[model samples]
Target: MNCEKIKESVSIRTVLESFNLLPAKENRKTAFYFALDREEKIPSLSVDFVKNKAFDFGTGKSYDVISIVQQINKCSVSDALKYLHKFDLSVLEKESVAEIDYSKNYEIIQVGNVRHPALVQYLKSRKVFEQRHLVKELVYRFNGRKFFGIGFLNDSGGYEIRNKYTKICLGQKDVTWIKNGCNTNNEVIIFEGFFDYLTYRMIEKEENSIPDHLILNSTAMLFKVKDKLKVYHKISLFFDNDHNGRDTKKMIQDDHDNVEDCSLLYIDFKDLNEWFCNFIEKL
Candidate 1:
């Protein structure tokens, strides 16, 4: 297909998903995706499904299907057009146009302490049962069915709900920042998720030595706490040992002078929690 025809036929979502990129936050008409060009804490790529186009708020650039492919793949116009040809336009169009009813997606049933046997076991399996107080038992309903998970509350009052079988969010997605009492600490420790933060607490023997904690809930939330992080004299990162984690760690380092990458401590494992679980298994 020609470039113009391809742009009109294929949705930007299809092109983005082809690169394994998903929306960070989305509504029916518009979705925010992580920027293609750089590592960031907040998603700045705004996609308009109706227009089949995207705008990078970070870079102040605009893209259609063809240009987006070119930007992500760094390919020529000819190659981008060839890549676009692989998509079945009819199916993509259907998916792109469908409206999601966010109001009915999920309902919060209860928020209480961690008492469920299954949830307790789940936490134990991760070697973080002692840190259970940091999270809550979230009972929610979705699609006419009831479900429950270990819920970590974020700054925006959303819950990072996790179970052995499921991982999801209920409400607005944001970071969870736990300040030391009276903001007395000059140092801060950053974690990519609540589990990792709990793992750090589990391994650290000295309770008083632990610094202020910021559970990003997602690396995408790093942007939300950038200014907050600047106040600390030392910033230690406990991100996962993966591409996204490493990228975010580097971004933090670039932005701050006293940054430390603590993932090297568990370099062989996927994350701090995984390393802790393996350590417990060995014991």
Candidate 2:
């Protein structure tokens, strides 16, 4: 299919879902997703179902169905068209008008210390059981069903909820910044997720002093704090070893003079947690 024909036929929602990128917020007319090009705390990629297009408020960039695929996959126009050709017209029609309920409405049933055996085992599996105090046990009800998980609170009063089978945000998605109780510290270490932050804590438990920590929770949030990060003298990034992680690390390096990419410590693994687990196995 030609680019024009594909753009006219496919819905932007279908393309996003095809990549497993769900909207963080949606209503009848429009939905918001994390920017396709970056990690973010809030969903700024405004998708208009009727227009069959998306706009990234973060970057002031607009995308058609074709361009959306190209931007997301980092592919050429021809490649994007080939990827879109796989979508049947019937599927496109169905997706164009389909109502996607992205509401994560839930009530907190309880929030307390991490004590459940399953949750404890989960922490142990990650080799962060001693760091369990840093997280909470969350019980919440969603769609009339009860569920529980280990919850790490963020700066925005939201929980980065995780379990053996699930990983989700239970409130506003935001970064988690942890100060080391010293006002003069100019160095801060950035992590891609909470577990990586916890892994660092586990590895450095004996250290009398440590730099401040910032957990992006999602790389899209990097933009929200890029200006704030300049206050630090030294920035250490412990992001994943994948494409997005590399991109984010490079972005920080480009913007700051004292930034360091510490992913080399876990160069063979996908992330620090994976490397820590393997290290534990060896011992």
Candidate 3:
């Protein structure tokens, strides 16, 4: 079979399971299985059922069904496909929409209100302490070690975890949607990160007029939220003044009407949060 046929025939979960690499944990949407070769106290491999792909966040290695078979079995292309041919994959065509979870390799040791002194200080240093209600203090363990960070919940049930030293996502990396009591879909605003959204909450003088918000968290996720974007009568973008952000702005403009690229307000700055912080410095 061709690559496309092969891809359609094999599932990511199947490849991992076929190797007898059982998941250490599983959330509703994702299976936290161990890597192909490496043994660990915690599983570092994340399997996305919705996307049919796997990522070893610990090693920064991504895998597909075929690649996974090759990795686990150490076999050639023909051999891998032959092994994958045992099961009829026709059922996957009508697969259920599973939840996307990212807690595969990490265990939450503690999750509390955003009250950790260091995390609070981190927010203050970024000029977003006032918007602390929008985040959490998440303490999780990975590889037998504990780590904590400021965490924001996205629409995908995963956390956009961040701190001074760590920026990795803690679950299925996805967008965060906020409908702040706007009855009609009159207007909508988009942000690349929660920091920008929180910064806007901190800086925007007009409170009641604030439209709904969508935080992509990562630019690669922009495609997933496009359908949601079409519902708004007016769409405003607050992306960074960088290549990925700028490119995404153009892409959105091509598909949506009444769209505004508001990044020009801080054209010289990197992002909305940067502009807010720098403006505060000047004041």
lDDT of 3 by residue, 1-283 (tens): 5666767656565556445555688754688887777877788889887787889988999987888888877889888777765432543222211332345777888878987655765797699998888898999875555667899998878887876545667867788878878536578888998999899888777655668888999999988988877778899899999999989999999998899999999999999888888898788
Best by TM-score: 2
Tell me the whole-model lDDT of each prediction, alpha carbons only. Answer: 0.81, 0.83, 0.78
Report residue 91 deviation for candidate 2 (angstroms).
22
Comparing 1 with 3 on lDDT, the higher-scoring candidate is 1
**Cα-based TM-score, every candidate:** 0.62, 0.63, 0.62
Per-candidate clashes come to: 1, 5, 2
Q: Which candidate is the best by lDDT?
A: 2
Native-to-model Cα distance after best TM-score fit, residue 142 in candidate 2, in Å = 0.6
- Summarize candidate 2's per-residue lDDT along 1-283 as a digit string, tens digits: 5667678777677677667777788875799999888878988999998988889899999999889888878899988887876554744334223142212567889999987766775798799999998999999876565667899998889888887655677778799988887746588999999999999988875545567899999998998899999889999999999999999999999999988889999999999999999999888
Model 1 residue runs over 4 Å out of place are 1-104, 182-185, 207-210
lDDT preference between candidates 1 and 2, better one: 2
- Candidate 2, lDDT over the whole model: 0.83
TM-score quality measure for candidate 2: 0.63
